[model samples]
Target chain A: MKLHTYFRSSASYRVRIALQLKGLPYEYLPVHLVRGEHKAPAYASHVGDALVPSLETDDGHWLTQSMAIMEYLDETHAAHPLLPADALGRAHVRALAQMVACEIHPLNNLRVLKYLVHELKVSDEAKTGWYAHWARSGLEAFERQLALLDAERKAGGLPPSVFCWGDVPGMAECCLVPQVFNAQRFAVNLDGLPRLMEVVERCNAMPAFQSAHPSACPDAQ
Target chain B: MKLHTYFRSSASYRVRIALQLKGLPYEYLPVHLVRGEHKAPAYASHVGDALVPSLETDDGHWLTQSMAIMEYLDETHAAHPLLPADALGRAHVRALAQMVACEIHPLNNLRVLKYLVHELKVSDEAKTGWYAHWARSGLEAFERQLALLDAERKAGGLPPSVFCWGDVPGMAECCLVPQVFNAQRFAVNLDGLPRLMEVVERCNAMPAFQSAHPSACPDAQ
Candidate 1:
């Protein structure tokens, strides 16, 4: 398998962490989003929209979108399953993952940031404000979710683990690592989100997440 | 079962259509997003983030995110399965679904639009421009995906159907209808997307899609 990725791309970071967690090795092919390498025809053919972190399977089929690609990897590999064994648990994990993917990260991604500066002609200060607004609000919601989950577990007399679900890191970890990285980059206030930041620290300490960090990627400048 | 939803929410519309497709009866409880009813303590207690289209199961679990809620419904009530049985096919269906859910819909949702105008103080012309830019670019990518799928099917000597996956409408259809409705409302110029529009037309002719449309909601006015 091969993955087309970019060093600073959050979505690309998500797929890398998932691959690492599953103990799956794939050739890393960098798609330079900053340099417009993704717009090349060869890459565009592989990923219809020229999105990064597209996985080309051994059988030659390509998959796009980090969540969908992660799900595909989980389905085909199935060793260290990213989702839970049961239906309800899977829904909870998915909901947590989407909170990061859909609500927070999408609004503050590279393209949207660039759009604020260039297309909308917003000043850098205001651009940063926009970033912090979405990031902080989204993380507040995430913090609430973690609190709710912990309360439920405590109510059932179950001990809490460092990971989002049980003792194993899964889809939510894949999402949280990249998001926390982005949050710190823009200096989004992390003071109110102690629980979420703790999970982020736990995830980053793992060898899998350490290896998948953007600084460790071949395309890191 | 009860669904917390708003009349014009694209995400809410997706789950409603899924429930209709599965032939399940669910009581609709309107959460007026514009009126800030989602932030009410009771509603917020049920959904941590106060997002709409939250499904309360008969067993008392509240599921959030349209995709996750739909998956839960599909898992618990399995008469009309939304995803394909095979892993690869399921991956394809999910990729298409996320193209709408993750890419297009997030940028144009009511909150984001409100942010663009109220917070950024963007001129109406530029705000509309921002909306069109993201919506059109995302849809173009989606159209390219459909074309690729069609080419692959033809190469495999498989016949094409009116729906995204096959003869039946499923998750992708749930996402596509709402997106197309919003596109037409914004005058995003759907002329270039004949294949997607054709699928949209076919889906709208179905009772499930028709009944789940925004106009059919009790608080649609």
Candidate 2:
């Protein structure tokens, strides 16, 4: 297997964490987004969305989108599952993951930031401001979700989750770690998201997550 | 089941299509985004994200995020599966869905547009241009993905997909149709993407999609 990744891309960071969590070894193929390698014709032709973090499966299929790729990994390699076994639990975990994937990451990705500057003609300060705003607000929502989940668990006679959903740092943790990395990179004020930040602390202490951090990636400058 | 939705929201529309496809009965509970009903104290307290298209299940849990809710419905109901049975096929379908859900829809939603106008002080024309730009480029990506899938299918000795994946309008179609609806509403250029537009046309011809259209919603303005 091969992963087409950019070290600094939070999306790529997500797939990296998933791969590490599954104890799967794959060649890391870097696509340098900052240098516009992702836009090169060969890469663009190969990847429809021309995005980083596309996993090339053993059968030679290139899977795009971090969420889909992560789910694919979880399904094929069931040990150390990224999602829970039950339907409702899966829903809860997936919603937490999407809170980061769909809400926070999309707004602050490279192309969107470039659009604000080169296309929309926003200032650099404004671009950073946009990044922080989405990150802060989205994490607030995530914290609120954790609280809701805690209350639900108490009602169901289950203990509170040590990670996003449970003690294991599953799917939601995979997503939250990367987004928090990006947030800290941009100096986003992550002041109010205690439960989410707590999960990040627990995830960061794990070797899988520590090794998957962008600084540890081969392409990291 | 009850769905908290706003008629014009593409995300809400995705869930509605899934429910209708599964033949599941759900009461429509409207959350008017334009008038700011989603941000109300009561609604916000009930829903962590305070976003529409949340499903209040039979046991009274509020499930959020269209993708998660749709998958939960598929898992629990199992009669009309929104995803393909095989893992790889499911990845293909989900990648298609996220191309809209993650890439396109998030950037052009109501809040993002409001940020562009009120926060960034962009003119209305720029905001519309922003909408059309992401919509058009994102559809181009969708079309490219379909072509790639076609090639992969041929390699696997399978027939060309009639809908997004196969003859059935499953999860990808559930997402694609509403996105196309919003694209058309914003008058985004649909000239180049024949495959995607074809899927939209076929989906529109179905009773499930027809009844789920925003115009068919109780809160359609």
Candidate 3:
């Protein structure tokens, strides 16, 4: 297996965590997005979308979309599952994941940030403000989501844990870690988001999550 | 099941089609996004994320995120499955679906558009340009993705079909229709993309897609 990755790409970082969690060994083929290497003909021919984190499976199937890639790994590997066994639990985890993947990261990706500075010509203050806007609101909503889950668990007389769902770090953590990394990078004031911050801290302590951090990546500057 | 929906929301439209396709009868509880009903105190209390297209399941669980909700419906009500049976096929379907759901819809949604126009004070022309920019490139990538699939299937001696993955109109179609609608609404020229438009047209011909359209909704103003 091979993964096309960029060290600082949150989406790529997500796939790395999933690979580590599943214990799937893959050769990391770095595609430097900052150098426009992703758009280069060599890389573009392999992954038509020109996106980082396209995983080429052992059977030689190339997959794009980080969430889809993560799910694929889980389905194939099956040792440590990313999603829960039951339907409803899977929905719960997926919803938490999408709250970050869809609502948060899409707005703050490198291309969108570049657009704000280049095409829109927004001030440095406003550019960072946009990042802070999505990060703060997204983290707040995420914290509230955890609170809602905690409330449900309390009502059901279940004990709380460090992970987002049940006793494991799964899909939500794959999403949560990178997002919190971005949040801190932009100095988003996550002061009141204790639950969210706690989950990030817990996931960061785990070897799978720790090894996938941007600073630990081979391409990290 | 009862769906909290905004008529013109692409995300909402995706779930509406999923419900209709599965033959699930649900009361359409309209949330007027234009009127800020999704962010209303009442709605926020029920759905912590305060997003539309949340499905209150038969067991009274509120599901947010259209992709998550659709997957839940697929898992619980298995009369008609949205994803492919095999692991690789499921991954393919999900990747196609996420290509649109994650990449295109998030950028052009109401709140982001509002932020671009109201907060950033971008010109009306630039706002529309932003919409077309993501839509055009996204749709083009989608078409290329389908083309990539076609190439693979051809190599495997598999026959072609109208939908993204196979013979059925499933997850990808659910996402594709809404995105094409948005593209056309924003006046993006989709002429060169034949394969994508054909799928959209085929999906439109189906009663499920037709009934879930924005105009069919009670609050479509």
Q: Which residue pairs come into collision in candidate 1? A: none
Give lDDT per model, in order.
Answer: 0.87, 0.92, 0.88
Q: Compose the digit string of candidate 2's lDDT tens values, residues B124-180.
A: 889999999999999999999999999999999999899988778898999999999
lDDT of 3 by residue, B15-95 (tens): 999989999999999998878888888888767679888988777777889999999999889877899898878888898
- Scoring each candidate complex against the real one, what DockQ results? 0.78, 0.87, 0.77
Can you list the residue pairs that collide in candidate 2? none
DockQ of 1: 0.78
Q: List residue ranges in candidate 2 displaced over 4 A.
A: none
TM-score winner among the candidates? Answer: 2
lDDT of 1 by residue, A37-126 (tens): 988898887666678879898977788889989999999997899998888778888999999888888889888899989999998988
Report candidate 2's interface RMSD in Å.
0.6
TM-score per prediction, in order, is: 0.98, 0.99, 0.98
In angstroms and one decimal each, the interface RMSD of every candidate reads 1.0, 0.6, 1.0
- Report clash pairs, candidate 3: none
lDDT of 3 by residue, A1-221 (tens): 99999999998989899999888888989999989999998877766578888988787888888999988888888888999898977998999999999999999999999989998899999999899998888888888888887876677677885588788989989999999998888888989988888888888889999889999989899
